[model samples]
Target chain A: MTTPPLPQWTALARDAVFTDPTEMLLKADRFDQTIRRRNWREYAAGVSGVLLSIGMAAFFAWVGDYAIVGAVMVTGMGFLVVMHNLRRHASPVERLPEEPCIEHLRRQYRYQAEALHSVASWYIGPLVPGFLAMQAAIFWNAAQDRGWEEALTDKGWPFALIVAFLIGVIALNRWAARDLRRKLAALETLD
Target chain B: MTQAAEALYRQAGAQFAPALARLARSVERDPEKARDLEQEMHCALWISLARFDGRCALKTWVYRVAHNVAADHVSRAVRGPQRVALDVIETLPSAGNVEAETAEALVLAQVGELIRRLPPVDMQVIVLWLEGESAADIADITGLSAGAVATRVHRIKALIAGHFQSEPAYGVTA
Candidate 1:
């Protein structure tokens, strides 16, 4: 345990003019404006999702497709669930000034890990029932026209594809969660 | 931002900009990215100061914001497997022998390289220590215990001292 004089790295600061506070403030103002605009866009997009879902549900119901209507409603509910989960778990890009670095880091890591860990429940689960119902409805309708075996052969691939895609999403999220947990564990050792 | 907050931001920039640059450089190997990181730190600091409650010293607040930004940048930019633990860094080979006349820029670059390899916490501690921050200040800024900061400082000093031309280690000038 030696207390050695460090190189004169601070001298670099002497001649360095990093940024003007006024310039930064102006930049901050522009940044805030941009974020505000982006947030409006996000809200608009979310509203569009809800409206589209509702519109589709209504259209399907009017067309005498109760199963499709049910599927649309469930999928819309899934969208809301996913949005809620995101609001709950998402970490802000800006950090509190007074919060300690380690605490901040820990909080961020925890949020990311937890979000990924529960991806199936909040992200994938809600949509799954809808997908299955829709597939089942499609299968049932097809079976009414064509034979059951013929319908399965014709409409089954999309079902398999959807299931496979959901599985892939779940796996990827889990893997990402595992990696974040490992990093979090390493951070914990510092405590 | 308030007038006081603006004044504080100016003061912090004047005081810690160099150290912040060094921190950014240590965390990012690319000079361009380092500059971007430094700008990001400034932007974060300015934004953070709007809520400054006068609870902590301006320096502490400044460094905390800057370090947090840099830590986040490192976390986002570099994935695991590239950063090594503190104990692992201790076991790694030193910069080897250096002539007394070794240019300060080269030594600084070597220091930056070595620092970039460290885990985030240790990296923050050592960077603050290098910038002449006391152990208590480092603890306050990093949220590590004072004793933890001290232990890290001691080990980091010993580790970095190996790179310089010094007798009894860590006595090199420039």
Candidate 2:
């Protein structure tokens, strides 16, 4: 197979690099929106967890159930621990150093690897433990006064809804995992 | 953040955005995928911005982020069997002021097909070169030594030259 001429290659490169005006701006705006939305979701979830714990504790205290209050505290504390662990494990962003050109690219590849790994951890870390802890709490609370069937029936719908939500969350997590894995593999090919 | 830091990011974005986007297009071969890569790079850059201590040129930092983002994308594409094929070179539309749009399109199509056949690294080198990256800059972005960059460029040029020698009517001789 003969190689194409320089002019042809140059022309091809020009076409490849040239941006469509509408598409370029639209992409930038869309990217900005995605970043904003992702940040908002994370913030909202964090706030919601804290609020839910506080509300649960207060409601239990008002009803004079010290035991339930303690449980709520444990749950709240567990959530905080998970959050702290996540923060600790989060990758630190690299500072670019003044360097010769080749060094810069090498650093860039290293940074990319770090960032991809960080994202992968974020996707897979909490779901399993968090799901188990919540389920255990539900069962423990329900078991205090009645059999499993009785407890389930009394709050079956809500429990069922929670189960459904967990399933949905897991499914979404799997999809994300698959996506990240693909990206990581592609990076490996480059190196 | 210092004024200098913020200004650095803005400058980095302006300088690196097009080249990074072009790289994404070459690797991903789909506009939508290219857009996704761009956004991911933008987010990565924003996250990493705080660590910018004026140690390196902002352009290099941005390219590093862009390359990482693209690498991640390529990895993901590999694991997903449903990913579109990488034979995108055959589909690229030609540029330049040709009188007949069809001829332009055909030339572009052939060029794209040939490009896809090159090794991935060569593809990257050629694409970056076409984007006006100097050999030194290409070495930096690609993590290859300068000598290696020259060698790869020489090989790529020869390959393109040979490809056109056999198809003269295409007017693609190097």
lDDT (C-alpha, whole model) for all candidates: 0.77, 0.56
Looking at model 1 chain A, report the run of 10 residues with the lowest lDDT sum: A1-10
What candidate 1 keeps of the native contacts, as a fraction, is 0.50
DockQ values, each candidate: 0.42, 0.18
Instruction: Compose the digit string of candidate 1's lDDT tens values, residues A57-159.
Output: 8998899999889888888888877776666666374567457888888888888888888889987887787778888889988998998999999998888
True contacts kept of each: 0.50, 0.16
How many backbone clashes does every candidate have?
Answer: 0, 27
Q: Write one digit per residue (lDDT tens) for candidate 2, span B1-115.
A: 4556556556765556666665665666566876676666666666566677666556656665666555446544653223332332323333324344554454444444444
| C-alpha lDDT (0 to 100) for residue A186 of candidate 1 | 76
Candidate 1: lDDT of A60? 88
What CAPRI-style quality would you assign to candidate 2?
incorrect
Best DockQ among the predictions, by candidate number? 1
lDDT of 1 by residue, B1-174 (tens): 789988888888777778788788778767898888989988888878889989988888988888888888887874534777676665333333534254455566566666777878888887887787777888888999887887777676666566553534336531
